[model samples]
Target: MKKKSLLVYGLSAMCLSFALPGPVAAVSNESCMECHSDDSLERDASTGHLASLFVDIEKFNASVHNFDEESCVGCHNAIEELDWDSDVPHPVDMPNPDCAECHDETVPAWAGSVHAEADITCYDCHNYHAPVQLAGRQTVAMMREAVWGKCHDAGASHDWLPQKEVHFRTGQCTVCHAPEDGSHVIFRLYDVTENRFLSCNEIMTGLQISGSFMANFDTDGDGVISPAEFQDFGEKLRERRFTTDIRAELN
Candidate 1:
């Protein structure tokens, strides 16, 4: 049985290798890295743009999409010929990777977003070569900052909001602006009594005071504590007004 299991595992691994896209399935990343790894391989275009053809293998290996099973050509499949140990002219009009093929699920949502309406693509927020997967508050903050800078300038665009800075800082823009029926409502850290958002330090301190509170509020064990849960949590905080200082948003 053990020998049969081992044989099955080996076959599965071999099939996975064969299933990988592009010539990278056969050619290793080192084949392309020989020339691209050279920082000196730079060119000046007729349009006066200085194009650098260097690729830092160290950073590429550490990227979020980096896997031991794939090579550079896996994403850059347009390169039909490999000129090893010879200087080949870099294609200035080379096409970007077919990210939509792999990210079909997320592509639609992204295409519908306000950023997409303004002609922003995935590469704008997500670095292709060094993509970092962000989550939770960090992701919210990053997106907020990016959108604000690119389009919604507080002084020029959002000057009409009452307490604009406070409103922007207290909660994510999506909390109030995002289509209510579009996505799930995400509960955020707030201070009901103060009518302001709780700082990271305040949240951490509250957790230290009572670690079991989150588990109690999140009855379904889902990451989100729903509006009903928020009301319950608020009431509890109000009841223990002097003792507890943390609360979640109701809307």
Candidate 2:
């Protein structure tokens, strides 16, 4: 009778082991990249648009969100694991990430903006993986590239503004358009050889700076670029044989 009881206990223990699920390994960015890296990877959205699922790993690495692999899952929580047998790993109705979760301060201001009123979402203008940082000229340039010709014609819409062409080139849309927002002047390097403004990336490459352009320029570490600092930065660029001019614009 004792031997029979031992056998029954062993059987129950075996059953319990089988019933419990083993730990699932946390999803890595590599796992997501396996499929998303494919340029042809696309899905049909409810709006009848073919939404591309392609993620450029290089650009993502360079982006501000390159902190960890979990960054992907942080935003896209629905994709828990990769199912090799299935064509679609995640649920079809997986919701978009709430931008307000991280951008609590910015979202409140954006919510009141004309873009929000027009049903423009953060995803509409901003790329999830390679989001453009809200620096002065770069931010304005990104906004212009995103909406111009697609949603707005600057020339036709801003006929009232003087030197509309120059404004479109040098000025930010938000300064005049978004009057509710405060304005600030940003000094940028204009490349005479390129006949265009030097991007942060270009400036960094030109100066051979290792970290942030702002950090390099803010000599006093005051979090604000003074007139002396701006002049010094321009001088450094000129020393590098870059035929550049400092252009200041309200943004």
Candidate 3:
């Protein structure tokens, strides 16, 4: 009877094992990087030109999307169905990923933007693998860096505007160029002595502020700097003997 009981237990265990789901084979970024990381990796394009397949792993890892959470298949879903053993691992033309999948809220705004009317795409200005995370003044800086020389000559194009260089430095391109988008004032601490903008770290050190610099200025805790708060901030800078002035620019 004990032998029969043991046999029944063994059969039940076997059935349980069969019922359990097996591990799915999911391709990771590392697997794609094995070949793509190689600088020599290139493929023949339909135009008879050699298109580079190389992906700078270091740059990609540093990008905002490199949280190790999303896989390469997340963007290139077609790659999952490809036969890796084949001589040509990639299709002749792999469609660009639908950025709206993640940026659903942003797509509608972008679609209505002046850039869309000009037929400019997200890929045109942005590098997918190593995109810059634009915040505050970074929006102006990135537009200047990416678009100024490559697409539009800012110096020559804005010749009609007096002190165009100063305007370009202090304001966002979209504020003037894409007026339909609207604009807001961004206050920055400028050092008259250095003739340059003071970074947040520099301001924190100069003011001897321990917590968030913005929070320190936003006295009413309203997230925005009121006129009273701005005046107080200027006083604090004066007290510290820091030759700094808060300059406002339309962004």
**How do all models score by TM-score?**
0.49, 0.60, 0.62
lDDT of 3 by residue, 1-251 (tens): 99999999999999999999777677788778878888999988777999888989887777767764556788787775445787766575788777798879878988988779998787677777776555565444457785445777777777887667677677786665665667777779888998999988888988887889777888678887776887898888889998877777765
What TM-score does candidate 2 reach?
0.60
Query: Model 1 residue 142 lDDT?
Result: 60
Arrange candidates by TM-score, descending. Answer: 3, 2, 1
As for TM-score, the candidate ahead, 1 or 3, is 3
lDDT, model 1, position 196: 71
Candidates in descending lDDT order = 2, 3, 1
Tens-digit per-residue lDDT, 23-136, candidate 1: 423446776776789998877855698877787777778776675444566677776556553556334466778678778988887788887898878765665665654455
Q: List the residue pairs that clash in candidate 1.
A: none
1-251 per-residue lDDT for model 2 (tens digits) = 99999999999999999999988877888888888899999989989999998999988887767744436888988878778887777676899988888889999998888788999898877787886445545444456775444667766777886567776676776675665667666778888888999888887887888799777888889887777887797688779989987777675
Cα lDDT computed for each candidate against the true fold: 0.63, 0.78, 0.76
